[model samples]
Target: MLITKIYKPAEVEKAADELRKGELIAFPTETVYGLGADATNELAVKRVYLAKGRPSDNPLIVTVSSIEMMEKFATDISDDARKLIKHFWPGSLTFVFKIKPGTLSKTVTGGLKTAAFRMPENEVTRKLIELAQVPIVGPSANSSGKPSPTTAAHVYHDLEGRIAGIVDDGPTQVGVESTIIDMSTNKLVILRPGAVTREEIEEVLQKKLDTDHHEVGKDETPKAPGMKYKHYAPDAQVLIVEEGKWEAALNWAKKQPYLVGIMAPGIEEKTLSKNFVFFDLGNNVEQASHNLFAGLRYFDDKKDVKWILAAGFAEQGLGIAYMNRLKKSAGDQFFID
Candidate 1:
């Protein structure tokens, strides 16, 4: 087993040194923590998949410190893409583009002609990439099919002793993944919804973007992560509680044979029975999005919690991203009675 070190925000140079040595390190983004590896080093990239138990065919996102670094592999940047990058590059948006022929290995691109690229809003991580002198492949730093890690400790919980180090920069703000748009073709497809909403991207481009590209066939490779696999699920069964259904959901929860977890915004703790464990989702959808993954992780430690009744939001803005992950965690199961 490898000794996994936690690097303080001041110790990014040491973390970069690990990446230079072709090691796996988990680093924070504006979204979730991402498993970092030298994108040009095929062996290092393969180890990332092995460490996360991720399917090799689900392509990883290449994180760059600058547009020039992205230009090293990504080809045919469109005017619209440039516009989005100019506005959102150092933010929560990821773009999937055609790669320059043979610039990235099939390991990174998953045997596809295109790859996903992003320049995270986090300065420490960007500096780590700049110092390492190579783009890094950054998949969410967690075990496959689990909720993405939102804090350095969460990464250590899932990946301790399996990775080299973690750059601890506190909890992530977005608490979910970036919005991924496929600019590889002219259609401009949204492969995943995230903190960067389609409405925001459309507002930037002055044109409506396509969002119906998430479905993939059994044998097909996905254009971006989260499209082709069951993701963000916890060990406990999660049942989504839609709006106006909390009363019914809680009542239903009271009768379950096993302990139930309540993840919502407004419920008073005193009103609940001992069978229910409450996790606050905060006052609004933004708070819910920020706390969704952490709440899911919290209940995972409570071994007796067999079911999580999480609140659901309307599919708009960050709600779209929140519900996307919540739906996956719940396996699309909702409280019906």
Candidate 2:
């Protein structure tokens, strides 16, 4: 693992000290552990891209301790954007806003005109930002194109020796990334879905939000992270089984003569048959979202697991975010029959 020191929440001041030195520190957020750097420090942000092996064109999300800090780095916040930010700040809602002139490194924005800014509700994250005294652009602690890390251990596994330090505040409360909204548009667009559903935002706004979800290519510039990458996939290939056809899927797997990895809700682990490694994601959509990536990472370590059969979940609430990751990781491989 890459952690030289795993700091506790009480030690955020030390982590912040590292940040001011233009170092990369992995810290816990409400959504996931992020590889954080001083956003305005060009060299520090460059280390983040290098440590994650992230594409230079893929912009990072600048996390703030408060609304006042966000204003220092972002500009041209519309009334609608301000309203949504007032409602969702200190939560898992990220907004794409126009950047202030020379406020952040070009690397942080990928030289784009706009930048993503967020205020995660996790206290540890806020404390770190408060201590650092600058906007911190934090992407998932894992390497580029990997499942976003929800725990510090996952961060260590993917970025060992690459980062300066890690703050182990335990597993994240929201197991997925934040919901990103493109307020740079005339009409707000849902760039990425997460624990905070679109419905929740609409309820606060009393207006419909545009859903903008088309996978982008590596060669193109995506409006936000998770928009155009093969993300959240484990080493084994994963497939989503259509509803009511799970029985057929089980039978098909039984004929393969190879061990199968299954991530499904309502799984009868004690009664399930065959040479299979079963991961119970629970029946509740929120539970599934919480356990989804951890389950995938669990199955990834299984030597006999070659394919993962995941039960389809309704795209409502957290399920929308869960299914989005599932679809990307599954590589469009859905069980039709």
Q: After superposition, how far is residue 242 of candidate 1 from its true place, in Å?
A: 0.7
Predicted candidate 1 versus true structure: per-residue lDDT over 133-172, tens digit per residue: 9999999999999999999999999999999999999999
Name model 2 segments beyond 4 Å from true. Answer: 1-3
Global Cα lDDT for candidate 2:
0.86
Q: In the order shown, what is each candidate's alpha-carbon RMSD? A: 0.8, 1.5
Give a tens-digit lDDT track for model 2, residues 143-213: 88777888888888888888889999999877888999998868889999987899999999899997886
What pairs collide in candidate 1? none
- Model 2 lDDT-worst window of ten: 1-10
Q: TM-scores for all candidates?
A: 0.99, 0.96
